[model samples]
Target chain A: MRVALHLAYNGTHFFGSQTQKETSKTVLGELENVLKKLGIEQKVVASGRTDKGVHATMQVCHIDLPPYWDDMEKLKKVLNKMLCDALHVKKIIHVKDDFHARYSAKKRSYRYIITTKQKNPFESDFVTFLEDVNLQQIQQNIGLFVGEHDFRQFMKTGSDVKSTTRIIYRAFAYQHKDYIVLYFEANGFLRSQIRLMVGALLTLTKDAIQAQLNGTKKYKIKPAPPNGLYLSKIKY
Target chain B: MRVALHLAYNGTHFFGSQTQKETSKTVLGELENVLKKLGIEQKVVASGRTDKGVHATMQVCHIDLPPYWDDMEKLKKVLNKMLCDALHVKKIIHVKDDFHARYSAKKRSYRYIITTKQKNPFESDFVTFLEDVNLQQIQQNIGLFVGEHDFRQFMKTGSDVKSTTRIIYRAFAYQHKDYIVLYFEANGFLRSQIRLMVGALLTLTKDAIQAQLNGTKKYKIKPAPPNGLYLSKIKY
Candidate 1:
């Protein structure tokens, strides 16, 4: 039987979402460990990888389970008990055998939050605080990210990817209390593109760039720090 | 000039609220270091000490500065920027020489929170999650805490305070979403008294103890773990 799990985690302690040798603290690794405790192994796959210190509000993953374990309510309880803290299993549902968490994803949305208020120790692990940023400028710069563009310049240099062009469905920036939240949705993204765009936007807002510099001209955008970015949702 | 600063900190990273020779990574120590950078040294004092892993929503402290440095707004910004991310200065105000951070307090309030749902990493530093708590039973037991009471049995063994009796102006437990928030206001508290009360209440709610096991009787009550308690508010 095929199963889909909607989940979220605070990524501060993980290496990243993808599994790596020796350092098996990734979200997938933890999920797999819990699955192993339930007598299942080698049956899980995630929607995508999130960089270290990145957070997620909703991420989808698919797993293959035995036919006898069909009661999702009981499974959720068991999983919740086993997973305990740090990770949460929001929902569980049976999916078509051929459904893929990565391929079936219609759009991915991300948010980057920056704060100017004095440090909030309670939220330090989840948000990035910037001492300087002009609100009006950041709101203005987000408009440039709404359309499709050749985002090779936004991609990290060492990222292994063939294409750099992607369609951005929506992009905007707004203030939520003390935080400046940058919201972006796209059919897909090049590696580190969101972070890069955020970094560039912050730079633009700070007036770090000269007036003659064109931020959207493909060669000038820099990736934002990883801590501020969160994979907020994935639509299937 | 004398200034009293209202502050808050996540005590998980600090040893506690007070600075000691062996445990110098304390909230007061960090603030003192920042003060030294501004040419003020050894002139800091806090209202009281909060134990390790005990958070504060509002902790008060006072420091003496040069008479010429009378700009409260500038001092606030300077200290907030200089302090580490784990400590924050919420508000600063110039006060008369007679004002003492510790002695000027009229009352102190604390809130202990416990969640019946799965652990939330976002709130890990702020709240405690108890797996099996009957909210209805806990709610019913809350009325037992109101008014003044001799709380000797509810306090820790080595507490050498002058009095065990305290005036509780408010005491109640309420459910908010997945969490149960327990609030208490008192002239003062004996060490570990709130934690002990909470632990006993949880046990009673779970049927681990008979309903007759109130602290009013001569009985020993175990203190809940330190992570569940917070020095939520200190009034001056």
Candidate 2:
């Protein structure tokens, strides 16, 4: 039977969500290790891959399980016990055999957190600290990416994708206590898309951003660090 | 010249605040390693030592420096550059030659954070989450720790302290958004005393807590984990 697992990970411990060659630590590699120990040699597929140092609060994945692992509660307990604290299976449910974690997703949401306060040791890993920022300026330009556009310039330099066009369902900025959160919802995003958009929002003017969205201006934009980015949700 | 430095450390990457024999990744050990590289071979004296995984936001330490390293700003910049991200020197100021970090401290403040929400990977290291807790009961019992008392029962075993009694200037609990913060201000604290007191506050009845403070009750109380405890401030 196939199972859909709701997962959450700190992401600081793992190299990234995707498994890599050689014995590098990644989210899938760690999960598969525990599954093999439980006598279930199955591969886990994530909804999407997250970059290194990125966190996830509601990342979904699909895995096939044997008949003996019918008790979902017991399976979740066992998985959590064996997995390290940085990774966890929040919930597990039976899914249709054809349900694919990556392909069946209709929407994905990402959030980038920014702190204007002085950098503190406790929050350094989760929130990006900026010495100076114009909140009103960023908020005004964030809505420019709300509609569908070809985000070819915003994609990471070396990534290969057949299509660079994606729909942005929603994009906005809000203040939550001490942090400013940038929320982006889309049907899909290219590699490093959100970070690049956030970087553009921080550095480029309104006209520059529009030119980039129009694919008329090609500027070398640096993607924001992954520490402040979180894969918040995936909807099917 | 003697200089007092205000420091902050995440503590998750550190074994403890004090230096240990062999190659241990300790706060002082890391700090001293950087100091030695700067050619300042003086030992650092902290206001107090925190247990493994106990964080500090304003831990003060005193170190004597050579006259060649007279630029305080330059010294701070060099120190921060050499130290790891988990450890930082927040501020530096010259002090009298007789000044000492531990001996001159008049009061120390510690804060314990408790979250009633479900455990999440993002906040697992900074906040202690409990599934079920009677907040009102813990609040009412926390006041019993105020004032002077024989806290021998609340200290960690095998700790060779000169005295077990200390004056508690203030003790209270307050709500901070999603967290319940327990604050304690005292002239001094024995090793793991706050954690033990917090454990009793959570588990023991009000009468039992009073008995423990009076030295009439001796319960083998397990101290709360160090991850949720922070050495917030030290006043001299």
Candidate 3:
């Protein structure tokens, strides 16, 4: 039986969503371990990778499990019992064998949360803090990257990607009390694309710096910390 | 120079507000170390004590410093610089030598956060999760705690205190989406009094349990986790 599971996790402690040979704290590693504990020898596939310290509220994944796992209710209860405090299995739905987690039909959305001026001890792990920002200016110009554009300058270093052009269906930044949330949705994202873009946006909010991308060179403003980024939703 | 400092801290990592001979991680231990580094060797005092795993948004304390430490602005910066992420010094105000953090205090306020059904990864460290709850009933009966009452029935074990009668100014619980916040204000609190009261309130909301009292005997409903409680304010 093929099952799709909607999951959420706090990425601060995990290396990332992908499995690594050296650590079992990654999202996939935890999930796979729970699967093994349940007496099921199946491989789990995630929709995409979330960088270390990046949270996820609605990430989707698929797995081929034993026929006994067909009972969605029982499986969720078992998984939740084992994974409650960290990773969560939000929902489970049956899917055709051909449905792929990464390639399956649609868009992905992400959010980056930023708090300004002072650090909140309670929110330190989940929000990035920046000072002296002109949030109004950033919000006004945030739509510049809404359509198709070459995001080569925004991609992180070390990944030799063949293509740099990607279409951003929607993008915006808004304020919620002291926290500013930036939202972006696209067919897919290049590694570290949103963080770099958010970093640039943050820089744009200050008078001291400007975003420089004349042709196709690397942009200033290092990618925002992964702690503030969240893979919020994946739509089919 | 007698100076009072308003402070806040994510107490998850601290032993408590007061220092202990064994652990150096108590809130006062950290504050005292920083004071020592600054060359102010006077004794430090706090408004009250908060247990391990508890948080404080507005804790108060007083320290008799050298006359040179009268520059309130500079002292706050120094203290905050030294105490960065775990603890924060919000404000520093000079006070008379007779003022005391514990005795001269007028009232203290606390907040208890409860997250129902699902465990939110971001708030796991700060909130307690309850499965079945009647928030309405909890709120309706919350006022039962207001005014003066003998909280001896709700006090924790092993604290040989003389008085059990305390005046509560306010007490209530309200829902905010999936989260419920319980508030309490009083002249002062007995060790774990608020938590035991909250625990009894939670049980009272349910159909099966009752808060029993038989002429100064122990009551039911285990104290709620310290993680969910926050010392929000203090009045001088």
Candidate 4:
């Protein structure tokens, strides 16, 4: 039987979502370890990969289970008991065998959190602290991202892809208490795309952002720190 | 010049707030290192010592400063720059020559947070997760802790104190969003007193708690984990 699991993790200590040769602390690596403990050796698939120090509130993944572990409640309880310290399985749903966690997803949403307040020790892992930011100006120009554009320059360099163009369905910013959240929804994103875009939003003017989106100009801006980015949701 | 500094720290990685003979990662150890770097060798004092894995929002400490470091703002900025990762110096204030962080303090307030929601990775360091807790029942019995009582049973064993009697000025429980915060204001606390009190509140009935407060009975409940404990404030 095939099933999809909704997962959440605080990725501060994780290397990334994908497995690595040097360590087994990656999201999939940890999940695979627990699955192996249960005598289920099937591979798990994720909807997308999040970078190191990035968090996820609603990441989806899928896996095949053997006939002996047909009880969903028992599986979830056992999985949580084993993996509750670093990762959480929010819910498990039975899905069609043909459904793929990556290819079947239509939209993905990410949120970037920035705080204007002074840096504190407890919340530093989850929020980016910036001083003297004009949130109103950023909100006014954030709509430039709400359309299809060639995002090659906005992604980390040296990546090979068939196309650099992708469709962005929505983009906006809102203030929640002392933090400002930047929300983006797109069909797909390139490697380090959202962080790079946020870096541009913080450093570039309206014309520079437009020129970069139009692929007519280039800017040298490092991507924002991954601690502030969260893979919020995915739709299938 | 005598000075009082307001400090806050996330004690997850720290052994405790006091300095240790073997290491320098304790709250005072780290602060002393930064002070020594600036050529000031005066020892720093804290209002009280918090145990391992406890957090603080407003902890007060005092030290005598050299004549060279007269500007309070610059001193705070330099201190924060050196210790921003694990500890923070929120502000610095000048005080009378006789002021003492430990001796002059009158009251301290602490908050223990418990959540009925499912366990998640992000908030485990700040909140405790419990199943099927009745906040109202705990609230009803919490008032018995107010006023003077012998809290010898609530303290950890092997702790030698001058007296086991202490005054709890206020005790109550309130709901905030998905969290239930148990607030305690006291003249002072014995070693692990608050955590053990919370443990008994969750497990013992009203009569058991009353008996424990009256020093007539003893229970063997383990102290609650320190991750959910925070020293919130100190009144001079």
Candidate 5:
């Protein structure tokens, strides 16, 4: 039986979303370990791969399991209990054998959180901190990323993708709680795409503030830390 | 000179709030060690002690330091940078020679968080989880500890408190996001008092539900996990 699951993880401890070497701790590695412990042998197929230390509120994945393991709610609880902390399979639902986790997904959304307000010790692992943030200017320039464009400038170098062009369904920066969150929904994101875009937006915001401070303006874009990036949603 | 500080700690890694054995990781031990490295020698006195795995958002303490340490903000930044994480001195303020953290004459407040909703991996260490939660019944019984009461039953056994009678200034349970929080303001609480009270309240809530369901009432009281308890505020 093929099963699709919605996963949520802190990602602070895991190496990344994809399964790499045996010694490395990855999300898929943990999943397979837990499944083996439960007497099920399977390989998991995920909708996308997130970089190291990146979190997910909603990541989709598929796995093949024994047909006898049909109680999804109970299975979810058992998996969460066995996995204990860090990585979790939040929901378990049966899927068609032909349905794939990656190819069947239509859109994905990622949110990047930056806070000028004080972040507590428990939350320090999840938010990016900055001294100055110009919200109004970020609001004005955020739409520049809404249409389809070559995001090669916003991608981490050494990543090979067939196309540098990707459609941006939505891109906006807004205040959430004490943090500024930039939400990006697109058909797909390149390697470290959302983080690089957030970095660029933060630079632009800083540049706007610098332009106000002095006559000259500057732009420097580097990817924000993976801690603040969340794979929030996937629209299939 | 005596210096008072506003302290915050995640407490997940520390053994406890007190400095015990020479090699233990504790809040005071960490503070004194950092101070020693910075060329200041002082024994700290805290307003109260927290048990293992407990957290504090606003703990008060006093310590004697080299009289030259007058710059509060810089000292605070250095301490935070040096301490790195887990435990921190949030604010550093000078106090009179006679001021003491423990002997200060005022109220203290603690909050216990209970969740029927899902707690994330990052937050699972800070909240108590239960299956069945009846909010209205718990709300109705929350004022049981509002006034002075003999809380001997609530205290963990073998604790050597001088008095079991303490004034409870306020006690109530309120909804915060997806969790129910029981807040207690008091002159002082016996060891494990707040956690035990929450446990009793939860049992009572379960009994009330059972009474409604099967027409049988029951009561069970046990100390809740230390993770869910937070020493939120101290007043002087």
Candidate 6:
């Protein structure tokens, strides 16, 4: 039986979402290890692979459990106890065998947070503090990223994907207390895409406002720092 | 002339509050290096030392600047730009030669935050998340920590403090959103004192009715996990 698990994890301790030979500290590897210990086969697939130090609020994954274990209630309890504090299973539901974690997903949502205040000792890990950001210009420039566009200029140069075109269903920036949150939703994301986009937005807000205002093709944009980006939700 | 500079630092990247022989990553060492580069000969003095993985909201420090650099406004700007991102100068005031950051401070306050919900990826570094806790019980038990008490039982085993009797002006636990913030104020604190108190409170709250009914003798407690505790505010 295939079980879909909605989960969340603190990516600070993990070496990204995918498993690596040198460092098996990824979230997927840890979940697989726990499943194996429970006498389940190591057949787990995730909705997406987040970069190192990136966090997710609702990441979906599917794992095959033995047919004999019928009680999902008991299984969830066992898995919760076995997993480390950094990883948590929010919900588990038995799904059809045809259910796929990655390919079946329709949309993904991400939120990137940046702070303008001095370093908050309390929220240091989750937010990127950019003291010199120009809030008005950044808010104005974020509208440029709302529609579908060839995002080759906003993605990492070495991304293996064949297509640079992506449909950005939504893109907006807002303030939440001491932090500014940039929301983006799309069918899929390129490697280092969100970070690069956030960086570019921040650069536009900070340095290249005049060029962006003039709609000039010749301009340079820097990506925002990585610590603030988060995978907030995934829809299937 | 010696001037006391009150500062705050996010200690996640720091080795500790004190300077070490091998690694100059301590808060004191960083400040001293910046002072040296700015041609300041004054030695920096801190109120107390904070452990690795700990943080400070308002830690007090004293440093002497050259006579030529007597302008406080310019000094603040220069120091602010010189310090690393993790370290910040909250305030820089010129004090009398006899004033000391350590000895002149009248009271110190520390706050430890623990969350009852699942771990927040955004708050991984700042707050500690415990699975389930009885807040009402913890609030009631905190009353026992107020006033002067020989906190030998709450002190860490190897703490090298000469006096265990300290006046706790405030000790209370309150809830904000999904988090419980425990605030403690005292003339001084022993090593790992706040963590130990929080640990004891957690144990007490786990069995609320019993703890509330029991007297002071039952207050012997464990140290709360270190990461959640912060040197929140220092009142001098």
In terms of lDDT, the best-performing candidate is: 4
lDDT string for model 4 (B49-112, tens) is 9999899999999999998899999999888888746699988999999999998999999999
Clashing pairs in 2: none
lDDT of 6 by residue, B94-198 (tens): 888888888887899998988877664446567887888888888887878788877776666887877888899988889988888999999988888788777
User: Comparing 2 and 3 by lDDT, which wins?
Assistant: 2
Model 6 spans with C-alpha error above 4 angstroms: A33-44, A68-70, A82-84, A117-119, A131-143, A146-148, A175-179, A204-219, B11-15, B22-25, B33-43, B73-75, B78-85, B131-143, B174-179, B204-221
- Model 3 segments more than 4 A misplaced: A12-15, A19-26, A33-37, A41-43, A103-106, A115-126, A136-170, A174-179, A204-220, B12-44, B77-87, B115-119, B122-126, B135-181, B204-220
The model with the greatest TM-score is 4
Complex DockQ, candidate 1: 0.47
- Per DockQ, the best of the predicted structures is 4
Residue B98, candidate 2: alpha-carbon lDDT: 94
lDDT accuracy of residue A153 in candidate 6? 64
How many Å off is the CA of B224 in candidate 1? 5.0
Q: CA lDDT of B189 in candidate 3?
A: 90
Report the Cα lDDT for residue B135, model 1.
Answer: 70
lDDT score of model 5? 0.82
What is the C-alpha lDDT profile of model 3 across B63-154, one tens digit per residue?
89887766899988888878746698889998899999988999999999998756667677788977877788888777778888877777
Candidates ranked, most accurate by lDDT first? 4, 2, 3, 5, 1, 6
lDDT of each: 0.79, 0.91, 0.83, 0.91, 0.82, 0.78
What's model 6's lDDT at B13? 65
Docking quality band of candidate 2, CAPRI definitions: medium
Location of the lowest summed lDDT over 10 successive residues in candidate 2 chain B: B118-127
Rate residue B162 of model 3 by lDDT: 89
Instruction: Please report, as a residue range, the 10-residue window in candidate 4 chain B with the lowest summed lDDT.
Output: B77-86
Per-structure clash totals for the candidates: 2, 0, 0, 0, 0, 4
Which one wins by lDDT: 2 or 5? 2
> Model 4 off-target regions past 4 Å?
A21-24, A118-122, A146-150, A157-165, A210-218, B13-15, B20-25, B36-42, B118-121, B147-152, B157-165, B176-178, B210-218
lDDT of 4 by residue, A49-130 (tens): 9999899999999999887878888899899899846689988999999999999999999999999898998988899989
Cα deviation at A105, candidate 4, in Å, is 3.0
Model 1 lDDT tens row, B1-236: 77899998887768888887886689998888888888888657887778888888888989888887888888888888888777888889988898888888778888888876666666666677776887778777766767788777777788788878888888888888877888888887777778877887876543333333344345456667676677777777
